[model samples]
Target: MKPVADATPKVTKSEREWRDELTPAEYHVLREAGTEPAWTGEYVDTKTVGVYQCRACGAELFRSETKFDSHCGWPSFFSPLAEDRVILREDRSLGMVRTEVLCATCHSHLGHVFEGEGYPTPTDQRYCINSISLTLVSESDQG
Candidate 1:
């Protein structure tokens, strides 16, 4: 069996610190584990080539090559840039059980992931991420 992912985060900060660091919307999604409205995220329809990093802490999470349009009203990725960069936990909110994706470094909530959706992705999984929780670094801007 595959080893269980680590639950400990590399960075820790108080709620007030996070609030001061992030914008209201970003704090809602990243710290409070909230979801953005459907089709309303900045990255939902973006097709740029680059990497998406955690908004709370600049940690590379997903690559542009892994992104795909799932029409699920959020940015979707087949997989994370690296497994260790993300942490998955069982979320049982809103009367549903789902896997919650978080930044491993900061433990900020990025979004939820669903599997067995029959997408053409290599992993057949969809990581529905919130645009507010991510900041894209376009290929041209990468140094």
Candidate 2:
């Protein structure tokens, strides 16, 4: 499904600006599509109720309610907040074919999504996203 949010992106920045704005780890994962070591991310077992937004551009990506423990060594979601909020592409890196998920607003790499994993999810898909690529806006903060 190629659901685009719009013809133009909502956020744009130069490489230097992105590097300056994000921390080294966040820049690597969010901007460079690097992965954090499994089971070491901050949100792996987190149960805090909140909306997860893109760390790079603060686009609402996932909600805490949809987060589930897939034991895949990363934060996993069954779906995004909305279809258009994320862009999925074929990632052929690491000698395997996988779907890469990115923030539709900024085009920043969030992580890979796998389908038919048989993880007991409603969608049968795992949105294996890097924790560093997201920021949790707790439900209390919504007010």
Candidate 3:
């Protein structure tokens, strides 16, 4: 699928560099478009307020205020930190069609975004992201 264009400068890296930087699990998810087992993610039940960054490129992608408990196992967000912060593309993998989310800066696979699910959130969209794909910088860390 073609990536959604944004004005943010891109971050390009070699395969070996990515492999060297990320752990096996992180690489699989962020670089290989892999999904972690449901309920196995670190941010599934997290309640801390923080900014969520792309694990691959350290780009701020989602804010803690946008996160919500969707009970879908993965960490869900109603929206990204900014529309330009992520790229959404149509995914046709695994014989199912879904919107694939990627970090705009590095084009790293973050996860999928589901819409019109009747969620009480303002956007009514659930960004079902893998926790392994993100790193949270809690409020305290910003101090």
Candidate 4:
């Protein structure tokens, strides 16, 4: 695994400056650590064929083919395109034990990952991701 420094986001601005650039919701979810309502995220029911990337740095995270309807009210992917693109941190917030996933490049809060529950994949892992933390890159962008 890469060192935490390589995955931790570097703050390039003052607190006030960051607040000014990102919306309250974005800052809350990406900076202050908050979550959006499940199933209400923009990508939950989206059928657009594309790649899901980190919103902050546009790093390719997951492909549409790996997405599945886990009925968990969140965008769930069987696995990430690159294991290095995301860093898993042990999150013990809200009195619950969960593995939180963050962007390796920016350390922006993505969501939590869960295992088991008979997922289609052999790993039985479900990466429950937040739509707000991602940007869908259309196929045309690959050119």
**Top candidate by TM-score:** 1
> Can you tell me which runs of candidate 4 are displaced by over 4 Å?
1-6, 10-14, 141-143
Instruction: Give candidate 2's whole-model lDDT.
Output: 0.90
- How many collisions per candidate? 0, 0, 0, 1
Cα distance off (Å), candidate 3, residue 66: 0.7
Better of 1 and 2 by TM-score: 1
- After TM-score superposition, the amount by which residue 99's alpha carbon in candidate 3 deviates from its true location, in angstroms, is 0.2
lDDT of 3: 0.92
Worst lDDT 10-window in candidate 4: 1-10
- Which candidate tops lDDT? 3
The better-scoring model by lDDT among 2 and 4 is 2
| Reference-based lDDT, each prediction | 0.91, 0.90, 0.92, 0.80
Off by over 4 Å in 2: 1-7
Q: What is the C-alpha RMSD of each candidate to the true structure, in Å?
A: 1.7, 1.9, 2.2, 2.7
Error of 1 at 42 (Å): 0.4
In what order do the candidates fall by TM-score, top score first? Answer: 1, 3, 2, 4
Tens-digit lDDT track for model 1 on 1-143? 12246666788999999999999999999999999999999999999999999999999999999999899999999999988888888888979978989899999999998999899989998999999999999999997
Tens-digit lDDT string for candidate 4 (100-139): 8887767778888888779888558898988888889878
